[model samples]
Target: MIEGTDNVSREAAAEAAASSNAATILPGATIGILGGGQLGRMLANAGSAMGYRFVALDPTPDAPMGQVADQIVAAYNDRDAARELAARSDVITYEFENVDADVAAMLMSESYVPQGSELLYTTQHRLREKRAIEAAGVQVAPYSEISSVEELREAVERFGTPCVLKTATGGYDGKGQWVIRDSSESDEAFATLSKAGTQLVLEQFIDFAMEISVIAARSSKGEIKAFPPAENIHVENILHLSIVPARLEDSVLREAERLAIRLAEGLGVVGLIAVEMFVTRDGELYVNELAPRPHNSGHYTMEACRTSQFEQHVRAVCGLPLGDTALLSPVVMVNVLGQHVEPLLERLAVRDEAAERLNVAPKVHLYGKKDAVYKRKMGHVNVLAESTEAALDWINETKIWKV
Candidate 1:
């Protein structure tokens, strides 16, 4: 579904990352990953297939990954626990970026963590990430750092109303953010958000035509491969659905791929990097945010692409040959929030009748989260069909939970 004249060919991308002396990690190596959420769980599943074992360091006991891989039950910042995990692992990678990057650097002196801490440090902070992106010669939304209410007010005045104020660290899924649609809301927004003492960044709101994401991987050998852009839809700041082969013009799709490649190369990311972007009505693209691991948007790749992002990530970190990123089918991926789990399971209990009624195969993925709370990502359903529209139709028909 990609269109455009300036697309980077897959062969050209592989060549750009070519290196003969690059470290080649064979199968059967134990891979240690930080954070044992669903990303770690999926990574473990993918690695296990290639004969690689996995150990995850996470604070959550009985974490999703614990169901599949060995679990080092400890906080990410626990040096002793990290040391234990590292001692048993051949090479380490991480699923979440919010963990202590300094601790990661500390571990680098003792073990082989090819994915490096530099990308984590740069991406974990909003201001720092924007600076890094701009430094790489990429475009981002007009933004300014705000330290105080006065600063927030001034930035609001300059950027105009209808801008977004986000915490510089520890915010996701619509949390730790405020939308100031009018000057009058500035004080309340700043007062409410700044109480936590985290630094903040205010960005001018772009009336984007669509939100899209490009998931790409970079191997230890410097190989780069990008999945086709995914058009994303968000509800209340949470990702609700992802449509692959994004319904974007060829030029915009090509640009998204180029930007993802640039970010992976420029950041020296050894695993996967998901670049979320905004495509304006005028067809201009702006980098919105970056995730230094497998992303929710790329979940469709599990069923729709020749290589899933999880497997590609395992290959990249293991220094194995990168897999092809070609799409196998049109797909729509819908998030299964905590609220959706009960109803979904109930529907499933009814047996083949529900599937027959839906008239489509829904590849359900339950993360095994113990509790289903509002807005928490419990799992997802990847609907594969002949067309994006059909997949989306099935998704709408099958979604029974009230989000």
Candidate 2:
């Protein structure tokens, strides 16, 4: 058994052996995906470029990923559907971490899954993920589990005000989280979140100088490669922009990459892992969280890196040689939320200055969704230039993208 990981069941070990032995699932084979979101869509696009077909199992009908690949419209927990998906593909991976790990384990009975279920299990819950990071000798925020109102109060007292309270599971994009700025608001926040009947974790909020994320990929052959760190800006918990080659001291950048690589190896992950980190005003670094798949912060890699993260994930899971993660240019990727969709579409219909300039050159990707809801990610635009500042300036100049 690998240190810092849960003991693998006999069934899981057999699956790993089968996968490792079947190394080099060359192009033209099908790759099965568990979730069909934007990440899956991008994954399918990358896999298609390599002559590999993709099939996704997601509950949402006509999901973004489904638009690009064959899809099985089934709940992630449906064992029969999972089995069918595994049987039809050369190997399997997931787009998101929220998929049931038990289903992956069931698939392990026969199918080969390079990105094992253990990573999904560890990262699905906030407390478990933090524990795993700490066990790997990584620094994380001080946190405590809160199951009851009293426990929540106690944690609030210990961590003090301005700490964050988050559900142990099923939370993302700022959902299932509350910022407790005062002791008095603890009761209300706890009551509101507890209504969902889930355990919560109270975390000490670090006053970080900046937010950054590193997207790293590990091949089945144990080769690891990391993209340049991306400085992230979030609006109401949703990523607004990602600027590659983050403005940071050289030592800090190197440390971020080192920590990310260390975490990926410690987890024994074969696919991509995005490590989110916080660099304190005092220059101390702390692991914020882990996403065991391609990350939104890495969207810039599509145009800026020698190997896009999406393609890297496909290569890693297929047992192919890992691609170079060298940066090709400074880029800024800005998320296009649903609220901006209408304005963007309207602008594109006419030959206005914004539209005309965008015609000169634009890298707009719109996810085909049925409805436009505020704060929901509809798509993104990547601006590449000589420098990060230049790219961001161009992005800002695009009036239609000023969401």
Candidate 3:
């Protein structure tokens, strides 16, 4: 819960609630963002172009978004700081779903937060998120809730070996999860994950042929638009590449989009929601996870689509009409991790010559992050080509990142 929220004056809360009823937030309104990460940075960039000002609240001084927007360096649950942000902005939104739900609810009551806290609460917990997906008439991997080692062992035995045990909350980027290939590993996996969170879930390991993601935006007026699916590849649990127009049967792509739209409407989202799915060898789709903001996989839309996800997010949260999500080109987005930053920089030094030599030009975007740690996402490159395979081949030929 946000500290000192009870101190808010009744008159102030009433006024904020009134302002939130405005049908649309026009340009020139100040937008407050909750997380000051790369997603917030990109959101600020898009909003700025549309004549909006930004204020960000984050714990990190000079965070990536703080580099561009006015930043209040404070903890997310700081009531005073949150009130300051609410007072200065016409609308508020968060960049990530891991934000404290209680704080988000406080902000919603004190500011115009189109994307409400309920979505955050549901998506932040894996068990709740999976249940929400199932409620939306979408298919998710079969899972069971576990509260103890005995429960986990029982669930694993019921589901069979080669299942996954994951904490219900506070896990991302391959963290807080263990794959139990054999029953022997259940005790260790349970002991390790229980330290992170008491609530756990065990899921059947899916033998997927490929992974894909669809980013959909929904406005307060109930307008929804979905972007093309992007086939994603991960290396060591970090996103490596996102290829647009996922090489799948047209029927499968349609089903993926249909599922995304259904989930978006069912979730009643007022902002962007990225739905990641697993495609089986038999062409079945299973919902893997959901992200309630701009996604890593949707980065390809920046260069390959008529409307970038960043701008679309601004449109969605600001109560404006959703933009056209038509694909403009076949594109591949490659993540530049910490290990590739130096090499990428060296190549960038000779970028013109490299483009000339490779006969492919890649648009590079680097987040102004201070450190270059292993597997940390430093930036991404979008390569638009005649085909997804051609763009992938260009990445391979450049050898900038080990494909």
Off by over 4 Å in 2: 1-22, 347-361, 401-403
Point out where model 1 deviates above 4 Å.
Answer: 1-21, 351-359, 399-403
> Residue-pair clashes per candidate, as listed?
1, 0, 0
Give the alpha carbon lDDT tens digit for every residue of 251-330 in model 3: 99988998999898778788899999999999999999999999999999987899899999999888899999999988
**For candidate 2, lDDT tens digit of each residue in 1-403?**
5555555455457646755675688999999999999999999998899999999999999999999999999999998899899989989999999899999888877798878788899999899999999988899999999988899899899989899999889988999999999999998999998887878999999999999999999888777889999999998899998987899998999999999998887787889999999999877899999999999999988878899999999999988888889998878888989888887777667664642444323467887877888888999888776777666666677565555
In order, the Cα lDDT scores of the candidates are 0.89, 0.87, 0.89
TM agreement with the true structure for every prediction:
0.93, 0.92, 0.93
Ranking by lDDT: 3, 1, 2
How many Å off is the CA of 197 in candidate 3?
3.0
Instruction: Please give, for residues 164-254, the per-residue lDDT of candidate 1 as tens digits.
Output: 9999998898899999999999999998889768898999999999999999999988889999999999998999989888998899899
The candidate, 2 or 3, that scores higher on TM-score is 3
lDDT, residue 267, model 2: 80
Model 1: weakest 10-residue lDDT segment is 1-10
Candidate 1 root-mean-square deviation in Å: 4.8
**Shift of residue 140 alpha carbon in model 3, Å:** 0.5
Model 3: pairs clashing at backbone N, Cα or C within 3 Å: none
